[model samples]
Target: MKVRFYFITITLACLVLTACNPQTNQIEKTQAPQVIEWEYQIAYQRGMEAVTWSLPAVSMICMRNASFNLGGGYNTVYWLSEIPTAKQEALTANNQTPYANVYLNTKNGPVVLDIPPASNKTALFGSAVDIWQEPIADIGPAGADAGKGGKYVFLPPDYDGSEIEGCINVPSGSYQVFVALRCIPIGGATFKEAAEYAKNINAYSLAEINNPPQGNYIDIAGKHLPTLPDYDFSYFGYIKELMDTEPLQKRDMVMGGMLASIGIEKDKPFIPNDKVKSALTKAIADGYNYLEYMFETPGFSLIKQWEGRQWMNIREPSNDGFVFDEGEYLLMDERGSLFHWATFFPRHLGKATAYLNAMQDADGNLLKGEKQYKLTVPAEVPARDFWSVIVYSKKTKAWIYNDLGRVGLSSYDKENMKLNDDGSVDIFFSETAPEGMESNWIPTNGEDFFLLFRFYGPQESYFDKSFVLPDVQLLK
Candidate 1:
């Protein structure tokens, strides 16, 4: 009976798909509420999965009673669908925790690989996580050889003493290794949740690395990978259906679509089934109902709360002095802020905005409050492109009011900005415009705001830590 029902439903859905009119077939209100609700939940969940680790061009994070989407930071996210097999093995074999040395057991004891310069800037198993590899036929085990399996592992930083005795096995072929000195910084409860999240995400990332879709690979490192496949798109249709009818499912649908958009899409339509038609016009009407729900309770509810955080344990502090031990919130910053946060939408959802706003500094100043920030681009930032800083509202988690709906200030504004005596540049931010800084002023409207610092054509100064940003503090 259930099978029969599904078949009927799918057939109807297919018919609906065929009849869909690009111009006039939109879902409507006062329609099949039950079916719409169900579709929305399914769409939202799937959409979230597609984008959980995929990078985006811009993303929102609830910070200080406002939405803080890292619009232009300097890192990226490699979705599992986008990784290559060879890199997966490299990432596995090269996995190293803090303070652990690789050893080869000769009868006279173990000899480690020639220790390279701590400044080599090469990961111990760097090549493995290269996001480069040939397609693999079998994903589980490569060959009969245990060593050849090329299985990757991530150990906590504090695995010392007895934990070091056991050797990790790998394929017998000659191999090179790189170590990633990476750690995550997050609150306690959030970290724990993120770790579990990471585990699921890692599975997806590895899957992509092992068997990327052919022709889906984007050009990188002077080569092309056919491994990364476009994200599953049926979910969008599901969201559209849900949004039209189900109120509770509205937030999840939007969240899901936003998340899925973070991964490889190959120009696929961002909106749900632009090609489908609906026989039950009532169902189409449901979409209107869903949009209405988006404006109501928990529709755009920005607060996300955790009993505490969950993340990997910190073995050592990062270059930024933030401890990244085991079981703490771990976020990858290799991709610029915009890309990384965009894919990890779940991290910024729920009570996150409320929590950020809750951080008060005792004198009643907002913790990480809005301030008149002075930004100047020295002649030396790195990248092939330009950069920008934009702000969003905490309560709404959307880009705040913009005269031109611009998200942030960008290098595109360089010619329009005031120049400095030394060839550097300057920009300002504040709740109220300062007396003489109108040209560079970014208005805050007395609300919380996040500043994203970006540098295009970044040079050695960026990689070598010669450039740093002043803290975001409140101004009198």
Candidate 2:
């Protein structure tokens, strides 16, 4: 029978949904409880859990797959010759700097990432993450290489390699890894100069270390790179590929069984029946909604960055790396929430940068592109390099589509920006430039949008909560 056909085979004694009323914060009997098919319910619930557990893995593989589609394979750098725009199509990606990435595979032996030292004040920022999206190590001055630059090696899971040295040896738990780097123009360097310097980044297998292979770099500047995870059946396919390639972890054995219930197994061929596919199809859609709910819910993970403000920190204050290991158990929801909308976190929390999320105005209303909002950046931002505010569609968690090729405003645009007498700049967000504020404005495409304020080289005042960013006020 079809999956919906079983929906009619409902039984009594079970509520259709056990949701509490938001206003009352309590369960009520005002509505009658409905019934659901037992077998379908069991499978659907398991499918939801599978989506949550496998989010990071699926997101990582999405980047790898998209890279391959762009004619770049494993251990080849995909560097950008210019800043990203809407066409880049990565989740919560910024237009602040040029991105450089390398998809690494170490099943055979080990892979090497040779990052060049900072020159002319241009440096790389970001981390080398595994298939799980967990940082194997941070990559810049604030990271393992300490900006001096050196050879970094990624070893396959449990590889019996003899004494590894002279390089940052990152032991991986999976065969798939990716190095995500952003080239920043620091100390009066030009963006064009920084983009050119990113070419020095190289990735090759350990065997090719002596004679590193050349000319595999694919420039993704202003190009369409589809790297965002989707709520489709193919999402599970990515997870399965990861499972098949990665050595099984003791902690994931239970999750492995859950995935099997939905016809996704590591070693076995996947052939889901129509009935099973129907359940999973619905599960992914609902699971995405659940993640959105979690992101907005209070006391979940979005902690207010400034005192009594609506702006929130993207990741909760936790130990660096976002493992969410809380001694007795893991914070699955917390960890999943981070990867759900964003990607590539540093191993050290706020070591090189800080991110603050803005979804609502000074009042508690959600931000809409039809309405205009203005945020007053403090006269002295703690960012040493620059501070940027970018907008993304809240639904897609990606750049808002626009014809102007504009998505953000940063301190780098000060030449055009109109700053107040005190040096504080007022940044505007709306469908069109708010009267005469073109230079300090970002478009939101008349859709439900959110903001991410970034601080490159965050200073002591930022960490100590002294440099507080004010809330965005509605333009009345």
Candidate 3:
């Protein structure tokens, strides 16, 4: 019995040793010792953050050109061409001059106006044809006469002085208007000609301000304006330019940083060399590959659509060439002190308009005999540029009638605007007309119209919400 017990004990000892002792084969299997699951986690987080930081710089550059005088916004509309020609005509009959029409939507309706090269100012053509030209209107909307006290009219491009005063119905919603002259490619027109062209076709239509609907004016005192975040955004433009120049490097840094931030560490060393250099190289390469995979992912290829009216684009990092992305990437740090538009366009119109829907107010009721809604811009309104709350016709997609020959206001025109002691500005919207009020009125013509608030060089006040625009309200 003693001998049998001893044999059993010896067998148990051997088993124990095999389980606890390290083996050469086991160690060899893990040649890349520096790599571990946790290391990957860190790398991922860092890469994502890097991408977030770098994205908005592009938007800032785009925003500089987006201002009130120009009706600049993330998704502000631009007219590409206005060469009036018949569709059935042969190729030779079509005018290829690339004449364009810039448009803005106000409470009155969509304003479809065009500007041609003015023979007077050759020197101001480039800047004038920009969104910022003075004396902006030559001929106002043909639908201005179609006023039914509360109905909007449509105005086609070929709207000759016929009885076809384009007008339509108004839907219930909060709205604002943007007055945009046109877009001339970076070097498309001569500076003087563009400037003079802008001067000629200017102003929001308020021609109906006097006739019927009793009070004659639409109150917009509660209307709000769209604005950008406040930051030292000037530097952001330069950063975007640099990123465009060194695409690959920016990509590498972003990917690498993301991985690092996520706690991904270099765990395993290369074969036979448990050196730090090998491990580090592998770590970076892995991050790059992961980033590449993300770009090609199926979800990244599609564009984000907004409200059936606008189409937002997205950029694929791997796609070469001057390909433009449709969506804007937003970044707000934990404290909300930092706001970033990290996309090619600062405020992409389609997406921005979609976003605007969320904050829109419920407009007041409009009786058939009612004329207009009176509104006032809050004193603390946040924006770097001058602002004008114009009206747009939902049916005809054109601006309403005006006497000031103005559709919107700008910072440069501050002296010309009437302001409250608190710095707030007054604006009017109506289908008929406002008694005694002429210059600061936006005609809505009773149809549904959209509004846009443009900021030129926004300051910190705009982002912090210290300057809040009023909601659109009906005057009793």
Candidate 4:
């Protein structure tokens, strides 16, 4: 499994220490070592590394391609006029609120994102990310504008900070940018009503900021949108496209160089030969399985939210935004595992929202479909907006398909859901309702699943760990 680079590293280290001869007491002129022959194992190990490196970028590409498929493109705005359903298959997508999304291409020049301020009826909550899924700016009240609304200019790598006036200027390293936001119903307004009010937000070329064309808008609510990355030789195609399209980051020079060994290069047309194709196909599968193993690993110190409970936060609460950038080296696995189950990395936490995950039950067993489980939420929740417990299939990281067409339960369903004598709520997960608990049930549909506890507008207790959420307990 040793690649040519591995041998080079070893050989260089040996030369530095052992190349000095005792007889001469001097450093000898070293002869160049032969490069190791390439093989499937070499490509396999490198491909796995590439998957970890490329997951974030590839996921962004998947959504951007979906944007084009939905009759939208760079600068064309699309939104879910209603809450998302299973039909919208992006990773761990929220089913609670309406979503508005737009992709921007800054290859030619800068792009302008015009966000409307928090009004009487509607306010937006979300972030804009570069193609790497790195947060560029946060939107809405808790964001860059602080709810007053401002024009955000996405400047390209080549653009200087000159003559750009009266707007938030965001300098982006990658050429492509994705902006996604949720429409929050405000001042007693309804969710759907707020979606209509969100039409005021728009993105266009900075060249036409003065006379921007009437914005393009499409409602992708009921569409069967597929935004998951492929795990085959085709995955390399995404790498090739980015190589041809965007600038190679300084940090990624090593991975970019390794990609060349497997037939992906910017200067050359991406036509993989039989040998490269065979190596890549197997590499992707192995890479994905390794990532799956990382995701399923329990009690990893970073993801554990509550010390005593199985509830986990993908980004360690103290580490905001999951950058994993330690200045010495990028914690690739931390970033990879986080994006493995979710998309749309947020800029901040505990102010607008907080997400905690649980794949195992109280006894430390993986959540299963054939089994029944129940989680009890305390009477006092820290979310000012709302709290929801969502279930997604472990295989797809997407919503499960059940006859009831339900994915999760939220505080919004409190009236229909039965509560304990103490006012705490019991939400069940099984093939069917737990006797009279039909209103509180989230169906598993015979598929192994995981849970996402979302606290929207989470209060201080959530951050201070005073409001501890309980684990899902197995039912007899």
Candidate 5:
């Protein structure tokens, strides 16, 4: 009996030893190193995509906050009396037109915009953008009135109200909408006259239009507004704020899941552990690097308009509303790249404007401020309304500040500029104006800058790849 008891006790002791051994415990509790590494990598990749995909929304939130800080919050219009000068706080602005805008929140009910009729040479060109900066509708010109101007109602996504007759209905995809208006000074109208016409533009809730208050106008000219997101881990904070403000759609669920994986879900406190924080930091850096590379190396082929001239059309020719494949699957990467390079406003081919940018000079070198260059714009620029070329800082992506205080040259000012014998206009870019070329000079302030060529109301020539801009040539 004692021998039998000794054997049983020995067996129990062996079992305990097996359970307590560190190696055995590790074998049961730990995952394979490869598995853990793969999980981490997947998390990192999703984090990167989340940041890239949410850039537009984050940009909207940043702009909203900046506008609020600049004294115009929700439901108020901020009017720029003059064209955006170098000191104007904006992501990217043009000196050709006076700007006025109002941020609308239609959560409670529909908001009514009373766009005054175009008077004389003053006309308003407006566009309504959702939270993602997707073009909801063109407001003034290229809208239902075709620049005649009329009352327009912006309804929320969940709006199920009776249709009101006579008013153009603009159904928005999100609760937050931005009505960006530009006052074009045509027919020799002055900027001040155009600004006065912009000030007459009114926006108010349908419930309060009968007793509407005087329009709140916050002049943002020469004032600084921080519209760009902080390019760091803190950028996630802006994303979180955007998620909280804008309701997520069914298509955005995947993005929401990705954001949640990085501890940035809506209504949740974003308190990430050290490991997660480190992973997110690395992901942001990787995303920026990848996007920069993608911008430099054109992923989509450019439709060469002229020999040796490459102009990239941001929108896909076949697709209109959404960027989808033949299978109807969303091209997330392509969409992300387009928004990263330019603004979030995506319009249809015909009603929309086209943008072309050049970072390098003709000699394949970065455009430096200290160097002198010339760009000869071909005659008969094919734009229905107008066209302009604006120089911006490569770093800020905003208008370059210079001693001259000029940000752009427009076709409207063609009379003042000298045209070549062939009718092409030569534009000069230099720190100092070339002799007898003050009218064509665009100052660079001795800092690196890039060019943005805008074709507002682009015609068939632009889409057919018939119109091409000349390269910037280095002056001898």
Candidate 6:
């Protein structure tokens, strides 16, 4: 009876110790690995999309900042006498047009942009974008002014004034504005002439227009502009800066909440815990890979430009000004993919310009510089202003450098090129030009490259799919 009592007592004591001991309780609490909360996971995903979608705008701001740092400072227009060839470090830049840019900060009040009348052979276009890179308004030839010289007043978002006559009112969503102007020198006018025309463009505050500061132009022809951010944990820093810089629009509220959940709220220091930091780093990398996959795959909502051809348009033809039926909350993947493909360009659609890119030849093989290929442009290439075909490095997305300084062939220079017997033009891509066909050859210098076919002021044929661009045919 004593042994039984002792054994029973011992068992009871063990049970109580095991159940009530602090160490045991602590061990039980940590027995299973910590699982991330569902809410946290959802927040992470939304944050990833927010970052990806905002990357294009942030990248443009970074580019403008880089330019300001390199070519004088803000409010000073940087003019590029030479077109952006592959040597230029801009993001997916075209090599056919000379450009000038000025960064505007209208935190105090309105700023005035004085656009000069373009010469007869020059077509100039200017667009003012907020810090988020959203297009506020377009000036110059294709813009509201219709190439006539005028003063464009960039008003703040909270402005409550009556409309000013004579001056075009541009309401900016953010105080920081980027004004990029493209000057196309046509009809034998040189880039020097284009630079001269760009120099005449000026920017000043409406309050100081009477005694405005002299316009400053810094030539950035061969200078390198570092615009791409390091694809790592530091990218979040850029996102934070962008969030703080741009005013929160209604469309950004959801994203802002997501960001706040991750400790990236505006006006607050972003300090993610180790677990969240790890998750975010992985998420960013995954997002980039996903975007690259979208670029390679066929289902990015890409529009088929030509039948039996590899050329594809990145954005849908029917998208209203790059906005879908959902307005700002449109398809995230499609919009993110478009921005990833080309970072710093307005979504002007087919009106201002139509863009088509070809990565592979008609045989569906990746384009290589060691091989020769030909693209035959049918006569009357349906561009109201002009058209150009530029070769860009697949890896860099910049102009492909070669022995020939030419990175693009434009219709403006068609008289200097050799045409096919049928009035169509055959442009060749190869490391070596054929005998007497040098003018038609665009040297690739043994590098993998892609082609960007641009139609400025595209006609109805391009939109109707009637102006089909020929496939790139590989030649021995």
Q: Listing every candidate in turn, what is its Cα RMSD in Å to the true structure after a full C-alpha superposition?
A: 21.3, 10.5, 22.9, 10.0, 8.5, 7.1
lDDT of 1 at 455: 43
Model 1: runs farther than 4 Å from truth? 1-341, 344-371, 403-406, 456-458
Per TM-score, what order, best first? 4, 2, 5, 6, 3, 1
Worst 10 residues of 5 by lDDT: 297-306
TM-score of 1: 0.28
Clashes of each: 99, 0, 127, 0, 0, 0
TM-score of each model, paired residue for residue: 0.28, 0.89, 0.29, 0.89, 0.83, 0.83
What's model 6's lDDT at 348?
Answer: 70
The list of candidate 6 runs beyond 4 A from truth reads 1-47, 297-301, 314-319, 324-328, 343-347, 366-372, 401-403, 412-419, 430-438, 445-447
Please give, for residues 1-476, the per-residue lDDT of candidate 5 as tens digits. 99999999999999999999877886666865454665467667887887778776777777788889978677788888766777764655667778888888998889988888777778887778887777878766677768888778889999999876778888888998887888878789888778878778778888876697778888887788777767688877888887787788777787788788767888889997777777778888888777665555555312333456543344452345533333455466666665565553546544646777676777667789899989998888888878888888766677777777888898877899998998889998888899998998889888788787888778888777766787889895
Which of the two, 2 or 5, has more TM-score? 2
- Best-matching candidate per lDDT: 4
What are the per-residue Cα lDDT tens digits for candidate 1 across 1-78?
Answer: 999999999999988786675445555432455545544554444434333322221111111001002121111112
Residue 393 in model 5: lDDT: 78
Can you tell me which runs of candidate 4 are displaced by over 4 Å? 1-37, 161-163, 298-302, 316-320
User: What ranges in model 3 sit over 4 Å off?
Assistant: 1-371, 401-406, 411-414
lDDT of 5: 0.76
Model 6's C-alpha root-mean-square deviation from the true structure amounts to 7.1
lDDT of 1: 0.30
What value of lDDT does candidate 2 attain over all alpha carbons? Answer: 0.82
Cα lDDT, all candidates:
0.30, 0.82, 0.33, 0.84, 0.76, 0.77
lDDT of 6 by residue, 214-269 (tens): 89888888777766655567878888887887777776677788888888887999
Candidate order (lDDT): 4, 2, 6, 5, 3, 1
